[model samples]
Target: MEIAAAIQRRGLLFVLSSPSGAGKSTIAQMLLSTDDGIAMSVSATTRPMRPGETDGVDYHFVTDAGFDRMVAGGEFLEWAHVFGHRYGTLKREVMKVIEGGRDVLLDIDWQGTQQLKQVDPDIVRVFILPPSTEELERRLRHRGTDSEEVIARRMDRAASEISHWAEYDYVLINNDAEKCRELVHNILKAERLKATRRVFLHDFVRGLIG
Candidate 1:
């Protein structure tokens, strides 16, 4: 049997953070479609569902009271107020996936990433930036889901979000979607092969030398 197949490896929490309409979500979908080992972390949110979003898939839509109760109960690994709405990741859901040796991909904002980092320092954080502010506004308008007011709000917030790029492990300029996706995929592959993450290799090396 191959060494990779025989050895047990631990999984990591892979995070993707970006300003709205900056291609983080698009790249996340691309990765999900191509990578079988990683799964999206469906966050619980108090925000209303959008046109094509599914209940449990896109987000776990919850009432404000329900979200408050979960927060009081310490159910979330990280929670943040985003765009006047509350969003959070359930601790149990993420723990189950990662403990089973499967990666969990998080599409969240900078605040949530900071909180998650406090909980798990081993997480891999990646930030995506648009090629230009004009291009970002264009992408927001192209989505056609948000109103003019919301788009304005997102544009206003983009500068603040982009300022936090220095905090991430890796930062990518998403000028070309395919190229950016390839870069993100390459980062995942390399992180998975990191020496610190491959602790089981110690035992394998001992066996070979003995």
Candidate 2:
């Protein structure tokens, strides 16, 4: 009983992926709001700042030269260029949270997820899916942020994204917000108990023998 309470773990890197309108962001927000043990991963980017975005909270802004330096030094777990701007998962940033025995949540695409797994094979991956293509398109348009043309392009991109669903450890459809959130919460709970994550278990089990 004492061992159970004192069992320390090397925290998990929780990767959440989905097409643009599949509700992964909403689910991530719900988890962050309720769970104190998990924190979101703030990626570093070379993109210009937008209005009201904090330098460190939203992203760690860097210049092209600095980003190149980081890449050369082997500092990023994963890095990619999107439409000419560069973004990366900072090696130190993730370790700070994970070393403190807390989960790190990531909202990334399938390509980023693959790159992350290559660096840390212990990472837990989940993919969210929309109930239907029509529903996905409806949600995208209902937001009223993108034009019809953009929505059509996004729908096309969604098909390509969904093709990688099989790469994830868990795939769930976002048919209902409440249910979707609950399912993700449960998955995190299960992943936390995995044998590899519990480094203290070896000593705990050893004590049981004597």
| Best of the candidates, TM-score | 1
Model 2 segments more than 4 A misplaced = 1-7, 47-52, 63-66
What are the per-residue Cα lDDT tens digits for candidate 1 across 164-187? 999999999999988999999999
Clashes of each: 0, 0
Q: Give candidate 2's error at residue 115 in angstroms.
A: 1.0
Q: What lDDT score goes with residue 103 in model 2?
A: 89
Q: Write the per-residue lDDT of candidate 2 for residues 1-210, one digit (tens) a residue.
A: 545533477688999999988898899999998788899888889988877789999899999999999999999889876535788888888888877768899888888899999888988899999999999999998878667887887898898999999999999999998899899999998888887877777887899997
Instruction: Give Cα-based local distance difference scores for all models.
Output: 0.92, 0.87
lDDT of 1 at 7: 46
